[model samples]
Target: MRLAMLDLDSYLLRAFLTVAEIGTVNGAAVKLNRTQAAVSMQIRKLEELVGVTLFSRSSKGLELTSHGQIMLAYAREMVALSDEVGKRLTGKMIEDRIRLGVVEDFAAGHLIDILSAFRAQNPKVEIDIIVEPNRRLAKLFEDRKLDLVVCDITCLSRKPTLIWTEYLMWTVRSDFVADTEKPLPIIMFEEECPWTLPTIAALSQRNVKWKTACVASTLVAMATAVRVGIGIAPMMLTTKPEGCRTLDRSADLPGPVRIEIGLYAQPETAEGARYLVDFISRHTAILSS
Candidate 1:
């Protein structure tokens, strides 16, 4: 029996994923080093082959169709696997050492997966990855302890290479509900956490009384506190711990607020550091989804 040719072209998958990531065909074109018209044609060809409208265009740019969303996960996994195979076969992957820092916004398991993927492709690279709060990471980066960092910061002295805007919602224990008689119980980062004051201000603005249940040193400890009936705490959608969900925020609680994740790197950073920055940026686009 003869093997049938696959209808889904890898190039088209590349084009589709690029467009999905960048939110525009023209942007995808620039990223893929293809002309805008060529990128559009490939997208059309892909839709024809797949028999689904993959994107909806608008003034803001392109949004994925429902079908496109369904297709995206599979496309990304398949493309990632193919790329890994290519790297293994080429045996020419770069090798270097770098100190990288990431904010505690990532789910612990998800952060491992991200780093594992990078390590698998470039086995000889030495990575010293530190997971900490943005405040600490920013300070470390400034002190030259970190070569590259992906973190959320309220302000930066220099522009970031890329940024992702997100929102934080109040997350609470599975069975815990606010008691009006008592101040709301909560767990959060260290005192210097930029959100701590804003969280207080938001609740105070509405006369929602709250108290600091605990200021955990690590994200894990903070999450553990939230898991065990601690008061509501703000967390990014992607990083909420198990058995906890975003509160409805209808009961005088603060709603979600905008946050920014940024990639900062030294201009003279090692190749490994630069590659890790790009790697994190590409994978983090859909983090809050």
Candidate 2:
């Protein structure tokens, strides 16, 4: 018997990709401007057409199945190609400027590489990026000084266009030993930093005796303090400096906090900003990993 040819619709593929990226039908619905039931039905229809279960629920939320994982790459390519073709045909490719704000952690990690690739693809598009704490970035976004912003979810009142979770660990120099008997020396970010309050609250709740050894305004300064053995500092796993290591369970440190990173765009953002948003959304898996 001959195998049947698959007739995949671009709309269905887009819905599948959106649901997979967002991890919930409701979230995908909000992003796609569709109802929850509509998004759910679209996912079901796409699964039926593809003849496989695409998503499975776990403690975290909806996760892609093995088949869905394979489909993700193809779906993204197809959807992006479709959008590109549509834009080309409609003469929608416009050269514009984008003012973007990002948290310092991301600026130190993947933001440079991401921006390089975006610039390579869009040479005509000009980008101005400000690296600051999430709280400061949120303020700039609110003032309409930025066309796009990527920051911690806690800093924003609006829904994010893209979101991912990362953990903050208690990091210290490799050879440094914490004196549990004495008050722990902690290197903390200034009050404007989003993680500062949470880190302090976690230590206080755990009844851990800690004193601020250094208060730095930048992530680089905080890392330097940790490396020089000033004190332990909370840092994302990806941004932890080479000389520093995270305190494990044996260290009796407070549990790491899961922070949600959000990408947000203004309602009337320029074409360049929208293009950059799409580019970042496509690269979320790589960025998170």
Candidate 3:
């Protein structure tokens, strides 16, 4: 027959992805509203179906096997597709406003894909986006002017969920060279720019001399300054700009601190905002370490 109708239980895939996301059977169990035994059984079923172990257990936590990592991608697409199809067929929609604030770095990249995916699942959801530095966004969050925020470690006081621990790197224009004899010339953002404090602290700790050559008030200005060889700037390793080159350790610059990108949700329904968070956490590499 038609290859036995080509079937695998989607619930097992959900269990697998959930376990991978939360990092523990117990955590996944609580999130999925299933018993520990039930979650274990589903994982076992999934492993058997795939003929490979999906997770390797350790005292630290469950780690995804290589096969598990590959499966996670397709698994998420399948789940999102299933959810989208069901929502579309049901024609049940929520038109609530979703006020979202995100860091400029993210707002320029896969944030579009993330929001598009969210809109696909939530057709009637009204999305209002505010793009700014994490410092400003944190203020909006505190004032209850926004429903959700994706920001850096400065706002960790909000007890937000950790998205990723991204490393920082020094970036310069392709042809520029570091000034070995003088204090390192630097391009920084506004005083409230989150990257500024950590970068300065790092250079200070290592006794690496640096001076702010330009304080760009916006990302475009910062990038433009770099393009014209104004000065080196600190940027997230994951979001390194295409035209700029990351400096090597030989440059004698102190390594920048790792930053934890996080998410905050308002106490109320925050319905559409929650959907965006789940989409990023599950669907994008934004949350990856």
Candidate 4:
């Protein structure tokens, strides 16, 4: 008896996963480094060989047909199997660098514990941690300079595949209550800080006069200013600086801003990317608890 040929190239599974997660042929094309037409063609070929229409297009985007959704479950399992096979053949999992960018506010909190866990799980993997404002972090991730980032964004452009929301609070010096009637002194990050949007919206709505007394590019500077009775700035409860406490301006501030923290990776690592995402997700639990 002759063995039938197998149309197996492990790359196909990864491509399929990207298309499903991103929901657009163009998005998947960017991840797979292929033209949109090429990506559509391969997906068509895969469906043809499998004898089904996997996805359907709509005004919203490419959505999985019921058949596609069912196949996605098996496709993930197949992809995992292929990775394990590759690892076995190589005698170890192939080492890769994960360039990670995060905002400084997270530095004072459980972010370190999350990184510690990730390092233990992936000891051979290298991580270059970049501490920057949310805007710069977004730019680096989009440019492929960073493989993953935990960003605080009101709305994300690259389409965060996974996200979690955290409550925002105001941090001010206890002594600053005396100047409540006057324009409040504000300690703020230079620009593009995640809290800036909500803070501005809150003050405008509350008819509060405010001016920046201290401007810094890093969270440390912002915390130091707030500690020395300089001004008020918004902070996440889990990430507040050691000496600072939340301001009791629930009435003056806009309802808690929902900071969406996310983990993003280029589409190629669709299978292995889960470990990093899960790590980040677990790390973010510190925010709520």
Best candidate (score: TM-score) = 2
Total clashing residue pairs per candidate? Answer: 1, 0, 0, 0
Candidate 1 per-residue lDDT over residues 239-289, each given as its tens digit: 788999888857577667666777788756776776676576567744545
Q: Could you tell which candidate, 2 or 3, scores higher by TM-score? A: 2
Candidate 2 stretches greater than 4 Å from native:
1-5, 11-75, 84-94, 204-206
TM-score (C-alpha, index-matched) for candidate 2: 0.74
lDDT of 4 by residue, 27-55 (tens): 88987789998888788877866778888
Q: Tens digit of lDDT per residue, candidate 3, span 1-289? A: 5435546678988898778867889988988899999999999998877778889988868888999888887777777667767767998675778888888877876477768767886778888899988888998989998888889867657445435666667889989888767988888768767777777787877788888899988767877888888898877554666678988876367776566777777645454665565577675564453
Worst 10 residues of 2 by lDDT: 1-10
- Ranked candidates, highest lDDT first: 2, 3, 1, 4
Q: Is candidate 1 or candidate 2 better by TM-score?
A: 2
Residue 178 C-alpha lDDT in model 3: 86
Off by over 4 Å in 3: 1-89, 237-242, 286-289
List TM-scores for all candidates, in order: 0.63, 0.74, 0.67, 0.67
Better of 1 and 3 by TM-score: 3
Q: Tell me the whole-model lDDT of each prediction, alpha carbons only.
A: 0.76, 0.84, 0.76, 0.70
What would you estimate as the lDDT of candidate 1? 0.76
